[model samples]
Each structure stands twice: as structure tokens, then as C-alpha cells.
Target: MTALPETTAKKLGLVIDLDTCVGCHACVVACKGWNTENYGAPLSDQSAYGAAPKGTFLNRVHAYEVQPDTGAAQTVHFPKSCLHCEDAPCVTVCPTGASYKRVEDGIVLVNEDDCIGCGLCAWACPYGARELDKAAGVMKKCTLCVDRIYNENLPEEDREPACVRTCPAGARHFGDLGDPGSAVSQLVIEREGVDLMPELGTKPVNKYLPPRPKDVLDEIDVLSPFLAPVAEESKGLAGWLDRVLEKI
Candidate 1:
């Protein structure tokens, strides 16, 4: 097991609030924007005008319509990305030492300069976090913006990853998961946050809080002014107009 560094600043991570996440792709776009420009290589799209066009993205949002045994209607939009696990399977499976966990902090990163374009890391990751960088002939995944977060030239507040900074609903938070007193740690405790696919025992550092229970629409009705009874006309045009407005 990789241990957290004591001398360096705490290892930070994201704690996503699933309850507040509206499934907006803002975070995804923000991640692509930052990584494509700053990371080793840009995520690419191939055969733009072809029928089998495809692209690579570090983060993706999955929309699931969940039907519970209790007959509740819920739509769960899970935003999937690299978990930066302590026992990262991707790192262990890499034959070329391209995938590694930082000793300075616990952040998992790929050494693009040393990569050999092996697909072992992608296959080992159950979360589907690793994607091949065809242009660079290596695997690519989220860096958590290592270059930006630790840069002294950047404003202290602007050091966090772009996704967390661009989240409009405030559903994303970045901080040290190692420190129990950190805001992210406290939020996880308070919200009973959960790990994705915990049965795999990857020990993911990032956490996701489940959405709260909500009432679903029970029925749909259509009202027509032409279908109303003639006797109801005595209620006056104003009252009839109000009912029509309400139904509409």
C-alpha cells in the first residue's frame, strides 16, 4: 500500500456531491479545456466526418434511470473519472512504469515521457479511467492538474483543478482526503459519501455523495377549454379563464 507523505503538503482530491450535480457537462468541458492545452497531449477526435467517429475524453457522465424495489423513479447521472486510488490497479498493471503514484503526494499520474503505449493499464482499470493517447502512443488519464495545483506562479486560490473551479452548482470540492479535519473530509463524513464499485477494493481516494430521495411525477393530465360543461360558464369569463390558465 502506498502511504501518504508526511513532509509534503497533504494529498488533495475531489469530493463530488451527487445530490447537487445536475448532470451538466460543464465540468467535462472544463477538464478537456485544461488538459488538452496543458497536459502532455490533447484528447483527440478521429474520422470527424466518418460514420464511426470516436474521441477520447478523461471524464464522462453516465445517466442511469434507477427503479428501486420500492417503486421509486430516480434518474442518477454519475460523472465517471479517475479515482486516483491508493491501491490503483492501473499503476500495478503497467509493465513500463509509465503509470505511477507520486511519492510527494498520493496523486496517481502517468509519466508520458516514459510510456510505451501498452494497453495493460486501461484493461486493469475497472472504472474505465485510462484511455489511449493515439497521438502520443501512450495511455492518458486525469492528472488532477498537477502542473497547475503546485505552480507557485499561479494565485493560491487558482491552484485547484479546473473542473472543481468551474462547477456551477458547487457540487465539486478539492482538498486533502488524508487530513481528517479538511473540509472535503468533513463533508464526506456528514453526507455519508460512497465510493464507486467499492467491492473491487481499489481504495479510491475520491468520494461521491448519493442524491437525496425525491418525489416523482405521479400522473399527466390534459385539459381542454372546449371540453368544459356549458353550466360552468355561469362562473363568469374571469373564473373560467383562471381554470383554463391553471390547467394549461
Candidate 2:
């Protein structure tokens, strides 16, 4: 069993705002595109054109329709990825020294070259955040865009993970969770960010800002304009079209 590092100065991780995510899947595609090339191996699909196609992806978003007793149904978009926990179970279970956490930034990563494709790390992770790389015969996961975030070759503004960079809603943020002064930490403090499944005790670095309650729309009849019958003044389809055009 691999032991975790003693301590870390920075808990470099992601902060996802559920209220702002639009379920666009932009973050998922951005992560896939950048990691496939930046990381050691390509995220390939097996039998892509066949009846059952399976592909590797580092991040995934899920949409849920939630109904409240008091209001209308709400659609929540959730993005999931590695949390880079302080007590990461995935690191402790690795038979080889392939999985490890960085003390510098608390980023958990698998050494692809040393990995044996045993699937132990995947099983150990409670979040189901890992995948087997069939092309490379190793375990693979989110690297937090280490290559891009710290790359001197890239512009400083372009240093963040592709998901954070590409989020149209600006729902995703990346920063040091360890520092109270950091934007991510301050956001978490202000929004009361929560950890997923806190009972498991992973001490996950990533935090999720809950969706703020929206103004009640149930009281307003949104379909009122369409609900009312077409004006009797308009006789037929052509006449109705003309009337609609005239109103505009």
C-alpha cells in the first residue's frame, strides 16, 4: 500500500457552480480534447462505429430534473471529475507505485508508464473517476491539465485547465483550496460549498457550490400568450400568418 504525502501547501482543485452550469457538456469535451493530447496517451474509442461504442473520457456531466413541492421543476447540470483527496483511497490500493498524490498541489495522478492496467485504482475510487486506457494498457484519469497550467510555453492567461477556460457560463473555477485568500476558497466560503458524499471521509479538495434557489416561476403562466386561442379576427392560416406578421 502506498502512503500519502505528509502535508501539502496547496490543494489545487476545481470548484463547480451548479447554479450556472447550463448542461452544455462543454467542459466534458474540453477536458477530453486537451488531456488526450497533453497527457501521455490518446483517449481512444473501441469499435467506435460498431453497435456498442465505448470511449475514454476524463470528465462527464449529468443533468437531473428536480421538482420542488413549492415551485416548478429545475434542471441541474453537474460536472464530475477527480477531487484529488487528501486521503485518497486510490493511492493506497495501488499494487505498483503508479498512483500518487502531489504534496505540492495535492493533485492525484497515475503514472501511465508504470501502470499495469490492473483496475485496482478505479475500484478504490468512490467517485468512479478513473478509466482503463485500452490503447495504452494502463489506468488513466484527470491530471488537472498539469502540462498546460504550468507550461511556460503557453500564455499565462491560458494556463488553467481547458474545462475552466472553456466554460461559457463561467461556472467552473480552478485555484488553491488551501489558501483562504484564494478566489476558489473564498467562493467556497461564501457559497457554502459542499463535498460529495462527505460520510466517506476522503477530504476531497474539489468543492461544489449548490444551486441557489431561483425565483418562483410557477405562479406566472408562461404559456398564457400561446394558451389563449388565436384571435377570431383572423380567419384562416394565411390570414393568421398575416395577423401575426402585422402584430410584429
**Candidate maximizing TM-score:** 2
lDDT of 1: 0.83
| Candidate 2 lDDT by residue in tens digits, 53-88 | 988988999888899896589999999999889989
**lDDT for model 2:** 0.91
Model 1: residue 154 alpha-carbon error in angstroms: 2.7
Predictions in order: lDDT: 0.83, 0.91
Which portions of model 2 miss their true places by more than 4 Å?
217-248
lDDT score, residue 123, model 2? 95
Candidate 1 lDDT by residue in tens digits, 1-248: 22323343555688988888889989899988889888787887787579998777888888888788887668877888888887788887777777888866778888888888878889988999989976677788989889889889889988998888888999899989989999999999999998888999988889998888786786755665557676654367988888899899
Q: Tally clashes: model 1.
A: 0
